[model samples]
Every structure is written in structure tokens, then in C-alpha cells.
Target chain A: MRYPVAPPTLADVAERAGVSRQTVSNAINNPDLLRADTLARVQEAIEELGYSPNRAARNLRTRSSHLIGLKFQPAQEGTANAAMDRFVHSLVETAGGAGYHILLFAVGEDEDHLRGYDDLLRATAVDAFIVTDTYLGNPQAAWLRQRRAPFVSFGRPWDDDAADHPWVDVDGAAGVDLATTHLLDRGHQRIAWIGWHKDSRIGEDRRSGWTRAMHGRNLSTTGLASRTEDTVSSGHDAAAVLLDEAQPSAFVCASDTLAMGVLHTLRDRGLTPGHDVSVIGFDDSQVAQVINPGLTSVRQPLEEVAVEIVRALEGLLSTPAVVSPGVLLTPTLAVRETG
Target chain B: MRYPVAPPTLADVAERAGVSRQTVSNAINNPDLLRADTLARVQEAIEELGYSPNRAARNLRTRSSHLIGLKFQPAQEGTANAAMDRFVHSLVETAGGAGYHILLFAVGEDEDHLRGYDDLLRATAVDAFIVTDTYLGNPQAAWLRQRRAPFVSFGRPWDDDAADHPWVDVDGAAGVDLATTHLLDRGHQRIAWIGWHKDSRIGEDRRSGWTRAMHGRNLSTTGLASRTEDTVSSGHDAAAVLLDEAQPSAFVCASDTLAMGVLHTLRDRGLTPGHDVSVIGFDDSQVAQVINPGLTSVRQPLEEVAVEIVRALEGLLSTPAVVSPGVLLTPTLAVRETG
Candidate 1:
């Protein structure tokens, strides 16, 4: 009838079960290696005494922390990228279901970021890391490999020749290809491409998708290619420039921000979006749906991607030595009102 | 010069310094208590041998993880609450500055959630927790207090009498007042209210601010109130219903999502937002600026609140058994094109 106020310890459970401390630990962590009868006795004792294994001690016993590291970036002011939200949400849900948690830490700029990673590694803070937004000569990739740390990036290694790491990236070229193909199927001859002017693997991959789609069929994309920054204002200016230079019937935008910008330009000229000039956007953001004319966009299978990333990371954690190849998931086109 | 492939250890440092292992440890972790000569000898040995303290060993010695836990919930599909984004961003930035890292975990449902919290606590996975979006009988508050766990909520304790925990909440009422006063100053006599239909401390607090402001000036809010779910569709529906029946000249929405919804309805009816009716929203999200006509909103001082929350929690962590009181922060008005 009387219950203990203090938390039940492993020693208490071991005493109740008449087993050694090592046996108790094995029952909790490596039950398969023990005899069925011994396992049953330890389990019964643990339940009867309401004993929960201490984390620090459990960590020492198993040499594992079921914790992954994620670099949490605060969104820049006045920016809303739903793709980032989707990826993190799906990744968290997937990882959590697998009994893993993410430790979020601020990654300092440049060399400081590598130092942060080193400290986390030295502190035994995480079992592995999920690096996003990777670029050429990314120090994280180099550091993780140098330390032989278990990790699976959510983006491709920019320098493929130099870097060898497990990763998962939604095929940007495939996503834009879907958008361009869909617009072409809608009987649009001149399909323009609107994207950022930056030099990025992702940006280049998306532009190439459009170029390949056009060149493959000889659809005459001349005077229809325009570039701008990732801002709505930039998209608007790019739209204006492209419109002045060429007469394109449709456009494939790199981001929802740019898509919304194109819509802004159309509205300013008192022109109907779909009827005057069809538009397809990448990243099926919530803004794509809320704008005056719904945006037909390419929806990255983020949930599937999350599941894949976790599965890959789990493989690394479980085996530790296997260098799994990279994963690439293709996005699907979401046909809404715009196109 | 040859370097050892294995990392330098405490034994190596102690052997090189010709001092006791405990003296070497004190040099790395706690140098104040050691004699200056002993500390200097150990430091020189460490520098010479390139010794780095092992994290697992350090953890066992200090019994602190320097890890904070945060529950990351993905916004429901089609829902975008930038307040969530702002709060996490500022909180992480502030905590990181203080040498604390956040462990982002997915909260399970009901009993599972409590179990997750308990597991994290037992595992020493996090030093403390920052509980947000608290409600009456929030199991986290109850469970943490019952176990004497260290945690500080980002929302006020809902059950005022029973739950006395350290918390910090933005004055929702004050936010509404800022929005209402701004509208009133724009020569609007009939200022309507749009908010959630649910019974929540936050919802009630926001509505009461408007009521107090109107009542203080002997102005009637009669036929000027509408409520809906915190979504754009609901906001649009509620706006339609209110505009049809209330005939108010201006509206104060509980959230930017709702304000955006109202704008959608107004545009549909061929009504210019500011000309026909002024509108104000809360949270001052990026949506406020991106909309056709910018929205004037009451912005929660999230960065300040983040600092305050961390400051209060840091105080509790540094000195145990001292119950720290809750903190409250004010909101400011951001004027734009809407009002």
C-alpha cells in the first residue's frame, strides 16, 4: 500500500530480480542476447519496482544516445519558405517515430560553424547530423568525414568529386521538368523560365531542367529566360523585363515567391493570370493557394523524403561503417487554377 | 614531429605534468580551487600533449548536459503561424548566445507526450524545457512539477490557482489595444473585432482589450463582433457575415491569418480595403507586407520575450530550490498600408 517517493533505481530492480547490474542493463538494452527466463525476470522486476534506467548511465552502458543534430536557422526577416517547413516537419515526425530526437543548435557563420560541430562531437551531444542547404567545399561535410562521424545530409554534396557522403535531395531538375512539361502539355508554345540569378547548384539544376525540356523538343525558349533574386520584388522586375523583351505564353518559376511576384505583375497590368499568361511555380507553398489565382506548382514529396532521410540515417547509426550512396526523390506537379 | 593518432587523455596529461589525475581534471574543469603552480603545470602539459577532455567523461564529472528541450510542432497543413517561427528563432538565438543548445523533440499525444518528457528528463537529454501553447490542465506543467523538473513555459499557466510555475507570455490584451487604438486614431468610429470562437486565455485576453478600449471611450462595440477559427477561410467567412450584418467601418483581427482572410473577402466583393474599411491584424507576419495592401498589425516583441524567458530560466538553473516568478512582455503596433 505504501509507495516510495524516490525514483526507483537499477540497483533496486536488480536487487528485486536477484540479478547482477550487467544483467539488468542487458535486459533493457540487449534483451536478445540474454536467456528468455532471465529477460522475463528482469522485465517483471523492472515493472514491479517502477524502475526507469538513468539516461547518463544508460548512455554509458549502450554507448548510444538516440539523438540526432539539426542546425536550426531562423528565417530571414520577411521570408516564408514552406519547403523548409515541410522538410523539418516530416523529418521530425519520421525520426520521432523511430525513437530518435533532434538536437537543434545555432551553427555559427563560416569557420565558427565547423567549430560548433567539433564541440558537439567532442561533447557527445548527438549520434548523427542531418545537414541541409549544403554548398561547395562545405566544411560540415569535410569535418564530419574527417571525424568519421555518422551523418546523412538532406542535400547533395556540391563537390561530388571531392565529397563522399550519404545524402537525400529532392531532384530540383526533375521538379522543374515536371512543371515545364505540364505547361507544355497545356498547349503553351513559348514557356518562359523565371528564377534567381544566383550561382547555386540548385538554381543551375532548375534552369537546366527548363533548358533541357525546351531543347529536347525545340520549343523555341529564346527571349523567354529571365533571372532575378529570390524576392517577390525581384520576380516582379524580372517579369517586367521578360515581358518587354519577349512574348511568352507561359512561365515556369523557380519558387513560390517568384510565382507570386509574376502574379503581382499581371495584376498591376489588370491582366488575368491563367487566361493572359499561364504560370507554374515550384514549391507548392501555402501562398500558391491563397493568391488571387491559385498557383500550379511542383510539390516535393517531403514526407517521403523525410522518411527516406531517417531510414538512411538509421542505417548509418545501426551499422556505423556502411557508406550508403546518396538518395534522390522526384517531386510531383500539383495542378491548380493558374496553368 | 610525430603525432599520436588517438586523442590525448587525462592519464597522458597527468603523466606529462607529473601531477595527480585529479589535479589535471581540476585544471580543465575547475581551476579556481587549484594552486596556481599546479594549474600552470597541468595547462602546459595539456598544450604540449594536445589533450582534449572526453565529453562522456566530462558529463559524468559535472552532471550537466547544457542541453535545453523544445517541442517542435508543424503547423497544420494550410496553416502558417509566423509567430511560432519568430518565437523559436529568437529563443534559439538567445539561448545559443548563452551557451545552451535546444533539443528539438516531437511531442507525442497525451500520455505518450508525458512519457517523452519523462524519458528526456531521465536520460539527461535536456537541462530544462521551454513549454509553449499551454492550456488548462496541461499535462506537461503537472508532470514536470510532480517530478520537480526544471522548466519554464512560454505561455502563462492557464489554471492560475493550481499551477504556479515560472512562465512568460506576451500580453495579448495589450496587443489588441495597440491595434484598436491605431484604428481609432484613423477616425474610425465603428471598429469591429475578429477573433477565434474558442475559449482560451489568449483569445479572451485579446477580445477583452478591444472591449476595454471601446468601453473606456463610451463607444459601442454592439453589432461589431465576429469570431472564427484561426484560419484564412474562417476569417473570410466571418468577414462576409460581419460585413453583411454589422456594417462596421473598420476591423481588428485576432491573427494575421484572419486579417488576410478578411482581405480575400473584401477583394472578392470589389471593395478596396483601406477605402471601404480599415483593418488591423496581430503577429505582424511577413504576410502583412506581402499582401496587395499591407496590413497594420500589433507585433509581439518576440526577441525581447525570448531573452526574458532565457534570463529567467538561467536564473532557476544556476540556483536550484529558488522558485522564480513568471514574466510578461508588451506588444507594439506596426503601421502599414491597411490602416
Candidate 2:
């Protein structure tokens, strides 16, 4: 009787190489482990029969692709500010240390990019995901939870229902409190807040913190000033409006970028930063150092937040369904000549 | 006699949802194609049966992962300048437009870090790889070639043996030629070159271009000056040495970051840039504008190069391997007050 022949497998190569199947697998995966002679024999056999180890077959036994996905929602195209650039750098360093590679996907213009999220999950392209630049009532987080896909958010979630999801967020409220309290302590009563969109969670949190601090000092929050956009031009325009309508002793900005704009506006109007009016900002970005008077701002621990996000993902992977949902990192006040 | 039962499959879900088996599969993989009612019914059935679609079974039939890897190698940690940041932004935009995602990986300092490359290959985490910051005699390239993995490099390789590999690189040599020729046209007889280590392919290419340009104009190529590190501090130190030893009418630097250092040194000596001496730099980074005399430099087409690299990878996947191995992109010289 004639019998059909089957292709050679790792077992056949292992027997031929005088090694165990696990050793052969390891030799293929991590060649540095085995002796040179053993590796050579296995390689020779693999070449002789044109045998390619099927990666899909192995991945079936192990339900991981050893890959993680990072979703970035930028404020605008062709514009990566210093804060976002540093965050991306930190993500790469922190994720690489955890033995997981990162896949970057951008949500451009389309606010409802949950279809991309579904494609990644259904295709099993990654073991977990990291989402950043979150907005109010983000649908992406809801979709991930519905599918039971593991993910971590870099910003605070707007919806209270999604608060149980894993996230590593900078303390925006505390940062605002630090800036506001500092101005109040310096005997500045009529303080103005600049650079924020009212709908944003971060903007709301920061405004609340400022209002609480002001109310604690027997001041009213109704007349507090704020701006819509955080650009340098916006800061100049906002400064114009503030100076024309209400003369505040100090101005608190949402970002250093905006503070730089305010500083320029102040300079054009013959006003010094620390002498004429005290100015404070957030993020303490590169603009802080380059701008004159050296901005006094809040410093967010970007590296620590990155590390915590990686740890959160690892925790989700190890326990499957058990994970602490949130981590709030503290922000420090960086005092300079501005305040 | 009792009959044995088989596991529930897509057909079972289709029957329960009153849809075709293909429709059920489509609802699982591509939900956009199915009606909301049909997708909801199919998904409910899938959840009730506690069934998970076998990814191995699907990938075996398809032979596609829909993922690509992008390897980013910075010169060192904390050295991601504006050019690098722009490169990453463009890479993401171009890759995402082609319906492919980028899996980003960085090379660490460990000698055994090459294992990360092997793991990426063995696990099939990506369909093709895009390598950046390639140096001479890189082990990563050799291993990828040995494994028949499809890849493209961002810079020229060290060894001519691997000349057949695909690469998309900025023409540093052409940039140097442009700078040198610009200075020569400005009637500068004695010109100095400030660059990085000679061992680097980029540094060597720039140096060769400078030498050839000088020789073309019948100028002396002796006393060619360079520094080991191309940073601001290094540029400052190198400029001091050049000023003391052989003072040239013009100075060509490797990068704007380094040019800032040179400018600082010249300023401290009470020498103006545009009037006393002319300076040209590569990479029109942010510092170029912040400096007193705006730097005349070669502005590399970072976004265009990134777009081309993604297009090359996509072409490699779609067509047969008949295309050329490498592509060189030209840089444009931005004329400013310094030059």
C-alpha cells in the first residue's frame, strides 16, 4: 500500500538536531540561547525542506500578538506642539520597556473613528490599546468597553459612566488651583483666566478649581474672564478684551503657548510681565524658557503618566478582567519671574 | 445510540439570526456592510453562545495582517528635534491614508536589543518594516535580509553589499553641495565645514559633498574642520576652535541646533553674523528663527520623504519585487540673512 507523505515539522527538525521541541522553538525564536552547533543543524534542516514555521498556528496557542495600539487625536494637522512631542517620546520609551511594541493610529477630522477601533479588535492586531487627547463624551471609550477590549486613556473621561475605565491622567484641577492660589497669595484679587473652550472637561475642571479658590477667599466667580482658543494670537486678542473691559492684576493661562502670546501682547503695550501684571500658565513647555520674564507655570509629570499607563495595561493583561480604573498624577508649580 | 455534537460555528449563528453564513461573518469582521438589525441579531447570538471567532483560522485563509512596522532610531535619547517630530507626523498621515497602521519600535542601548527585531519578525507583528537612522554595518538589516523580510531604510546603508535594499533618504551630500556652492557664489574664498563624526554615513556624505564643491571651484580642501557631536554646545566649542585656528569667511554647519551654538559663540565675541561672517546650517529647526540672524540652511523635505516611504512600502506589498532598491531625495536651500 502506498501512503501519502506529510511535510516536516519542528518536531522532525528537533529530533534531527538532537534537541527538544521547545528548544527548537526557542532556537527559532531566540537563537542566542542554543549552542552554535545545534542552531546550525536546525537551520540546515529548515533550509533543506523549505519549511517555514507558521506564525498563525503558534499565535493560536498564545492569544497575544505582542503588540499594543496608540491612538493620538491631535489639535491640528502639521502642528505638533512641544507638549505633544514630549508625550509621544515618553510613550515610546515607556511602552518599549514593557516588551510590547506600539502601533500609532491618528483620528484625523473624523470625531467618530470608532470603526478603526473595531477593526483593530476584530482583527486581533493588538493585545491592548492606549487612547490620548480624549474629549467630552468620547464614543471610542464606550465602544472599547462594549467589546471588552483592554485600553487606557491618557486624559480624563467626560462621562461619569465611563469613569470606571482604566486611565492615567494629569491633575488639571490641581494645576489650576496651584496657579490661582499663587496669584491670590501674592495679593492679586482681580485675576483673569485665559485660553480654554468651555465644553472641554479639562477646561471645566480647571475653571472649577479657580472658582473654588476664589470663593474660598470671599471673591465672586461670576466676573472671572476666559478665552475660547489657546493660540498666541488668541492670547493677544483675549488680553486686548481683558485690558479694555476689566483691568485684572494677574492672568492665568491654560498653556505656556498662550502665555507667550500674552507676554508678547503685554510687551507691545509697554507692560512688563512681573512688574505691570503677574502672568501664569500651564504645561511649562519650551516657550516658557524662550519667552522673556520666564513663565511661571504648572509642570505635568509626563514621564510618570506614561509609565503608569503602561503599568495599567500590563495589569489588565495579567488579570484579564481585574484592574484599577484610574490614576491621577499630581502637577507641580514651577515659579519663575512671571509671578 | 447517542450522536456526538460538534462545536457551534458561524452557520449556527446565521440560522439563529435568520441571516446567511457569509452575512454573519461579514457582521463580525466588517460590520459596516451589514444592516443594523442583522448585525445586532448576529452579535447577540455570538454573545449568547460564548463563541469567539478563531483568528488563526481566518488569517490562514487570508495571509494578511493589515499592519506595518515603522522603526524609529534617534541619534540618542532626548535628541528628537523638530525635524524628527515632523517626520513622525507625516509618516502617520501617509501610512494611515494607505489603509495601513504603523507599529513603532525603537532600538535601545543594549547589545542584545537585536532580539526585538527578531521577535517582530517571528511574531509576524507587521507585514513590512520601515527603518530610520540606519548606520553602517547594521546587524538589523542583515537579519531582515536573511529572513527574506521586506523592509526599507530611511538613510543610506554602510555596506555596499546591501545596496539592493530599498531606502528613502535625504540627499545630505546634495545639501552640502548647495550650501558650499551658495557660499562660493557669494565670493567667499575660505569656507569651513562643521559636522558630526566622520564614521556616520550622513556626516561622511556631507563632508564629501563639501570637498567636491570646493574642489570644483579650484579652492583648497586642506584643514577641513569637524566635531564629534553635532549639538549646540559642541558647535559653540568647534566655532571657537575654528575662529582661533583658521578663520574662514563662511561656516557651514550640520544642523540649526549646532548653528545656534556657533551664533552664541560669535555673539559673545562681539562679532555680528550677517556682517562679520556668513553661516549656513542644515535642518531649518525652530531655533533657526529664534536666533538673531535667521540661519540660511538646507530645509530637508521631511514630510515628502515620509510620504514617499509609505508609498514605497505600499507598492512593495502590491507589486512584484522588480522595483529599484533605493531612492534619494534632494534638499532645498533656504536663503536668509545669515548667508
> How well is each residue in B1-339 modelled by candidate 1, as lDDT tens digits?
111112356898899999999988789879998999989999999877545665555555556677788887765555446666667778877897898887777765554667667777766666688888697667788777666567889888877655556788899998898778877777787898999876766888899999988887789998899877988899889989898998888889998878878888888888888889888888887667565667888899999988988886676577343446777889999888788
DockQ: which candidate is best?
A: 1
Clashing pairs in 2: none
Write model 1 residue lDDT over A13-70, tens digit each, in one string.
8899999989999998899989999999999998765466666666655556677878
Instruction: Give the runs in model 1 whose Cα sits over 4 Å from its true position.
Output: A1-51, A108-111, B1-51, B108-111
Error of 1 at B4 (Å): 17
For model 2, fnat equals 0.20
lDDT of all predictions: 0.77, 0.73
Error of model 2, residue A162, in angstroms: 5.1
C-alpha lDDT of candidate 2 relative to the true structure:
0.73
